[model samples]
Target: MTTVSVPSQSRLLNRELSSVEFYARVLELAEDDGLPLLERVKFAAIFAQFLDEFFMIRVAGLLELDEADLGVRSADGLTPAQALGAIRERIGQLLTRQAKLWKRGLRPALSDAGLDVATLEECSDKEREKLAKYFEREIFPILTPLAVGPGQPFPYVSGLSMSLGVIASDPASDEERFARVKVPEGLDRFVPVGKRLVPLEAVISHFLPMLFTGMEITERALFRVTRDADFEVSDDADDLLEAVESELRRRRFGDVVRLELSSSASQAMHARLVDGLGVKANQVYEVEGLLDQADLSQLVAHHRPELKHEQWAPVVPPRWARVKTAGGVFDEIRRGDLLVHQPYQSYRASFEAFAQAASRDPDVIAIKTTVYRTSDESALVSSLIECAEEGKQSVCLVELKARFDERRNIEWSRAMEQAGVHVVHGFPDLKIHAKMTLVVRREADGLRRYVHIGTGNYNASTARLYEDMGLFTADEEIAADVADLFNYVTGFGRPQQFRKLLVAPFTMRDRLVEEIRRVADAAAEGRHARIRLKLNALVDPTVIDELYAASAAGVPIEIQARSICMLRPGVKKLSETIRVTSIVGRFLEHSRVYWFESGDESCVFLGSADLMPRNLDRRIE
Candidate 1:
């Protein structure tokens, strides 16, 4: 519970700071002594990746606003500059904690468990000799060392790649010079010289003379770059695929947002990097131990079952096997709305089987779906290609601007287009984030459509790792609504009004706000009312204000967000009747559920839209 005077209160929390707190929770998992050894190790790796993304995208965004002097502020009363300062200080604390957790807790515990992560000095003479042979044969040939001098301006350093920034003296001239040797990304992050594992960077630093044969190495320090990778395509671009490919190329050389420098680095060395990379003082970080903890995933090679979480195999329901029949999926759905949960209920057995059956069924006349993110070797895309080959009407809206997944989505779009699938390569300003599929079959009585609306992507691999839900239904109104949505996406102009489905940038937000008001009114009239929400994020100011109003009216609100919630619950007079829980750990909670109840009336909704502003006002849901 939190209490604040009316003059000092800000009803909403900072989204970026809330995200940092979420990552801090992830770090807590890494520091947890109760979890399995490798499980904690996995969280450590996840924390690294999370921090990388925060710098690459979130921090980079704030720097853009700050540089432009736009002064973008949220309800949390923090401008972009203020948020960056808070983020930097808090993350510094987290990084300090992270380094200690790995060096003091995890590494030592793993060694005790017989899975040693040894340093160069810990290795025996025999192991050193073996490592020397392996490094020369497997790693040396792949290495490229670039010297920075008069003509060779600073070499272009890619984001997230670690490199050794070296200042060496030419013996003849006794003049110091700079050079960079990027640790080979192709090689494994950790190398196995003997029984123990060693960081590949350590081995590279150990044998620096092989590249600069005659130079005397004076100062050497490891550093990594986090570049501003976020990009937006102009709405006026003529060719989306070409534009997206160009953006991908530009993203490779984005501005350096964060610089991870070795704490042992000299002030002069730091200045060389600061000037060379064009990074400011605040953007540079000094960290001890590992620069990229994500590489700790290499511990999976230890093969100690007792040290890791037990492997899980998803169980498929027997009834889902009815997809063997040509119209089996439709038959199953026609009976009733079939709800599916992943990692608990097999995704391949249900969704993939539905697509496969739809591809092969001769009675099926059309298939439409949206692909925001999918597996590299996607069975769903394969089925769509086969359907198009069979001369059926097949349409796929592949979002090419899916952040880091742009290249993959671009490749998928080209493949689908080549296979005669009517492909829509996303819009310029908006991303179609809804996960749904529509299948129209030519039954004995005219035509009927079957639809699958989901809270997750059509990704088979992520299905085993993320907990998500979807409904396969043949409901007439819902199917028609989905059909109309596809027409709006694949066709020209605006979409026709939806009869049942709540489409974002249209009716979803309005409908949700209306329901919240209804619940508040019921509570104000002394009737029992309640609101429950389970989502990944909640940050839209309007919805949060509505929730606060409902809470003040005596309506109870409970929210379970898997990550990044801006609502501050249990504040007196403001949100005294509200509670929120962030569900993290194990599988990621991916499903979104909205339930509002007032006395005898009740309503429920599920979709990909979080209460975030982008989802409610900009993107399609």
Candidate 2:
């Protein structure tokens, strides 16, 4: 067998691209005549939302890393300062592209479709009159203008809040003054005055003069700020829950990582804002169109299905109604193995069925599950509450530090605790990442355990958008392994061996490495060997190195990663046999699937794991 080596410079993908360039390309692709108009609008909206999350998490994380003086370099070989600089440069370009998309591409296409996002200047006389009345009745009551002067300090700017900075002169004294008014979240981001929709910032900017009757309005511009939202938990904290709550409080007061001002902002005003927010000039972004594009999601609900992808209703599993009517989902599991593909198949039918079964089954002795992110109206949580009400043994390991969902998880934790559900925060350090549900039942032979393992969260709402996979099995070995995993999470037991399951923080990574080595050895022996991995990210250096080694030994590797792939594919002498591609479309690729060709035999494993360092090294079962 001939082994091939990949050259370093032959890598296919860059470590990171300018977000501005990335989005500009997205807009460019969206405007292609080959794509549908509605699809283009959806792409535009998605690009905006992606930018919001990038600011919230990635930018926030980088700021925190710099503040803590961690001095850790990213996989792309850039320091925090360099990363921020690159991000700023990229965002400026993206903002320009966003303006172009709105002003040229989407606006015209929307007009053709009879849906226009009109500005105050573009409104007709009758429309203006209607807007005036609507503003007086609806928007005026919610306005709170904060004056920045000697007696007042800068107001606390909430994360992602769009506000207007008004420069006004007193009619009597002719002294310049600045006032800020945040667009209220309770109000719609897009105010529909007549048939046309207007941005709330535009509406507020137009009516600023009316609010200050005695003042001469000189200038006004829209601005927004992104704050550090990443939470850090102390290892020695007395109570994890209390520590998380305190951290959540501090998240609001975190150092500002970004300040987005209108391009027309005066130099003095920009300097004042930079000083007030304690951010550098490079951190400032001048947006032309909407300050926050995430709010464009509101326009997605304009009852214009023609402006978006066709609605996709999830398919009900064949056994769903049968299991639900049988008063227990475990009965079906006991009879046969079940497979579920999300978005195409419903998560409510699978997860809700587990909870519903646990709540009603008298023979079921215990129920245990791990929860990371759930909606405000979670069917899974509701079922758990029902189990507690029914006096069934229900234990939930709710991870309070699930990033953006911390506050919601805290509220859920309190609610679960109040409902008599034994809610534990899992290990103090490790996050419980494995998605599993254990149901202990009294069987004819003895105690039997049924388990459900999945590649995604137990959340029903996200199932419609995120593509994932789940397996329901009553196999004693796998069920026993799941029981051991639950015990390891909630108690002090660690299984020394697993028959069919791969768990992190123990043997998952090692097992994967071993499997890759086996394929490499077989390839070296002139047998066919291949590996396919589909994941959200690929950042673990160890895993990347192993894959590279396998590639050197003639093993073909195919990877489909949705975002943030550290490993560069198609590099000569390094990863010549490896190919990586990302698919972003109607459904978010969330499943982590690994398929290995073992010459004469093949194996597949699906679970809640990504090839990230934190997931492999720090997270628990």
Pairs in clash, predicted candidate 1: none
lDDT (Cα atoms) of all candidates against the true structure? 0.89, 0.79
User: Candidate 1, residues 15-132: lDDT per residue as tens digits?
Assistant: 9989999999999989999999998998999999999998989999999989999766757888888999999999999999998997899989988987778888899999888888
Where is the poorest 10-residue window by lDDT in model 1? 1-10
Candidate 2's C-alpha runs over 4 A off are 1-39, 64-72, 319-328, 493-495
Model 2 scores worst on lDDT over the 10 consecutive residues at 6-15
Could you give me the TM-score of model 2 versus the true structure? 0.93
In candidate 2 the C-alpha lDDT for residue 316 amounts to 83
- lDDT digits (tens) for residues 1-621 of candidate 2: 233344433322233453334455556656665666767776777787677667777787777777688778765567777777777777676677778777788777777787777899999988888888888899999899988899888888888788888888997998888888888889888777666888777877888888888899888878898887776788888899999999999988877878889888888778777876688877788877656766666766677765566788778898876764423577788889899999898777777767777777777777888899888656778777877887778899999888788888999899999999999997667887888888888877888888889988878778888999999889999998887777767777555688788888888899998888888888988898999999987877678888888888888999987776778777777888999887766687899999999689787888899988789888864
